[model samples]
Target: MEVLVKDFPIDFVVTWVDGQDEAWLKKYNQYSQQDVLDVRNARFRDYGIFKYWFRAVEKYAPWVNHIYLVTDDQVPKWLNCNNPKITVIDHKQIVPHEYLPIFNSNAIELNIYKIDGLAEHFVYFNDDMFLNRKVKPIDFFSKRGLPRDTAGLNAIQPRYDFDYIHVNNMKIINTKFNKKDVMKKQFFKFLNIKNLELNIYTILLFFWPKFTRFFDLHYPYSIRKSTMKRVISENQNEYIQTMKDRFRSRHDITIWLVRYYALVTGNFSVRSPRVGKIYDLLTTFGEAKRDLTNGKHKMIVLNDDANISETEFDSIVKDLKNLFEKKLPIKTEFEKED
Candidate 1:
């Protein structure tokens, strides 16, 4: 099955932060008001890998129309800001003033659609996520402009206390659109439990056994700007409340909400990549390195986890730098010549 092709241009949006910047760190500390351990563990590791990220995109996904590098008043000194294809966006420009100095990624992500002149069809990427293979527009979207569904529901147990965010996301859909309720009434009558008090995860396990956490993909997310706008418009109060969260909270819904909304609305066509195509560097460094060395996968995510030892973390960074340099040694037009 193929989507009808159009002349639409696809843009790439990346959220990044330079934690080592003294000004940014001071601002974060002032707002965080937390101890060193809490602040340090807040997923703020700087492996100095943005250059490789750009290199990967330039090499494998050269068709990308524009690259929006979102940050908090900090730009990589080596980046070519003068490049017409690259734009540096400060958080203050998109996020509301009240949410200023925000350190939470969810807050920044929720407002990415507000970016001026962003394409209606865009791919959102984290600084740690990279394209590992040559790809075209079809890999991200169909010819009809619908995003390819690279995710499915899973029945894995929660790994963090904050996993309730996933539940909250489902509950929002259930309460607002009643999509889940409709599914329960039509397909899940076998359980025969009145007023099912179980959480969304348990309910999904019982009925749609394939429903998994949407976030495990850890790859670039193909998004429709208008869909996100409509979701926020319909759920204005909830959206505002979510944006107001200064830090990640159990009540806050994950940014994957847009993708979930797309799935439930049948706006996306499912396209599952082969197993082992996506790797999380922190936990699967060995496999990730092997995959990169062999050029086996289309995408890989280098998640920064503070729980790992400094030595191990440094080793991973060094190895990743070496691998990326080996694969993409030449700098693209996006970088300034040294």
Candidate 2:
């Protein structure tokens, strides 16, 4: 008898920009001619964002190999790992969109949209999400092997736009818009190609102050390279045709339309959050930190509770080390390619 091994591989990509920098904030205020500025608040947000980003990496690091940091700023020394497999891309080198505002996260997606050809399996994560602990991938999706996550069945948040572009009158891909040769080369042919439909991608069109927290069917956590290239090629000009407009609502609509494509094709999935689960998990870590020992895995702290003693935390961490070592056998060290 022969043994079969199925390797479910994934890459990691993160969105990062230098909007929180003091120098950039100063220049921004001067250009807008504003005396007092709330840009300082953006800086604090970045710190919170990056702290949890580190947590996500630690949790998912076991299954992921290549990590790409999409940014316009100078890569931080800490992010510059000695490991050769980890790659960082500067936005200027990847996709050169100058007119897009630096603060807008949607514009940065174009930079990622350009790199869709690089990785086959990848996860796209927001900097704002807090990932405090490691989780098994199997637990995130449904066991039924269905195309979509249960997160979609829940009532759509009021802040989310359910009908952004109105996918009613989409047309066929005509000769003027279709290029078979380039599409073939970019691996766009793999997807279920269809005529123009309403843009229904992820949470793109849902603007804040009116819409947010869209129960997107598109894999908010992951995307295959083929999907990214296909949508961008099909809707590039339709969404981002204008370089003059800074408003993100239109561009977001275009992106959300792509998410709809994934939903229909069964290429996307979502992990629904459980009630009280967040609080329970956070409390577990707090108690475990005080009860564990040292010589354990490196735990990156994200919370700002000053009263928590580091010495007690180290003890609890030791217990977690033992728990993982005894229960989880898979080693997380990166393997080199021959």
Candidate 3:
């Protein structure tokens, strides 16, 4: 039952954009699509995503050494997270409003940059995501067999590449495509339209949900912290602004970053062996193994053990102690400090 703990500094950065404020919500509801979008951007600029994030941080406090909750505005006075391990840093501390858009990735990247310089590893995530298992850091970095390739992974459309490329033109040109498939194929064709694959990353961000949630486990990636810090510090100013104009906000920026990680880095596996699902495809954990051909490799899922809620947090900590007994033995009779 011994659990494993590695000698590395581990933490998480999450966006919690608060959206329930009556006045803000009222004004937010009033705007047209563009106006509402502006208000939404402002909300992200103020609070990333709120309620689920608040609960996630509080529940996972024991497993986490430090939690960086980035916001669109000032840290709300109502947030007095008592966990000594948790630190709520506002994005505003680094830069002001108009510049918020460009530095969105830099914001999370900067946080990782700051911590990675000192710690061996760090994990980053969004608000709505949750871990269904109680997991240790070692479990995250452990290698699995080759990942399965699911269909439709490359099924994105291209015409939506930019604000241009009218619907009429799409209708006339891709007459063979059904209305539903038009978007995906158009997106694919659009990226290669000018023989320019530059915006492919952008298309992956907005359209590819399977790719986004495929490897949802935001666990450890063993990169030198200082290296990441340098990446953040060098480009913080320019990338921050560029990203703002390029993406809608934090979510948009994260989608681009994940795609960047997938396409650029070879470290990530394409399938989560534990769940048997293609990391970025449209299937639930229950349906994960169903699509696959019967195979030899078995997936070890970490349900509550992967990531647990606060209510069950203590029990999981105790379970880790049991696991540690098996993997990392220590003197049990050591006297408790007075």
**Clashing residue pairs in candidate 1, if any?**
3-143, 4-143, 153-210, 153-211, 153-212, 154-211, 154-212
The worst-scoring run of ten residues by lDDT in candidate 2 lies at 194-203
Q: Give the Cα error of residue 237 in candidate 2, in Å.
A: 3.0
After aligning candidate 3 to the native by TM-score, how far in Å is the CA of 215 from where it should be? 8.7
Q: Where does model 1 exceed 4 Å of error?
A: 1-6, 34-42, 179-216, 275-278
Candidate number with the higher TM-score (2 or 3): 2
lDDT of every predicted structure (CA atoms):
0.74, 0.41, 0.37
Query: Model 1 misses residue 261 by how many Å?
Result: 0.8
Model 1: per-residue Cα lDDT over 1-338, one tens digit each: 54322478899999988887899878887867533223464377688778988988888888888999999999999999999999999999999998777776776888999999899999999888878878778888988888865434444367775677777777776665554554454343212232233324345554552344443456788899999998778777777776777766666766688987886666765555442255555687888888788777777776666567888878887998898899889988989988
Work out the TM-score per prediction.
Answer: 0.86, 0.54, 0.45
lDDT of 3 by residue, 120-192 (tens): 4455555434332344544333332111111112232433332121222222223422433433543443233
Q: CA lDDT of 210 in candidate 3?
A: 30
lDDT per residue for candidate 2 within 134-237, as digits (tens), equals 54444332333222232221113333232332321022122222223322332222222221111222223312222222243332345556676787666656
- The TM-score of candidate 3 is 0.45
- The candidate, 2 or 3, that scores higher on lDDT is 2
- 1 against 2, candidate with superior TM-score: 1
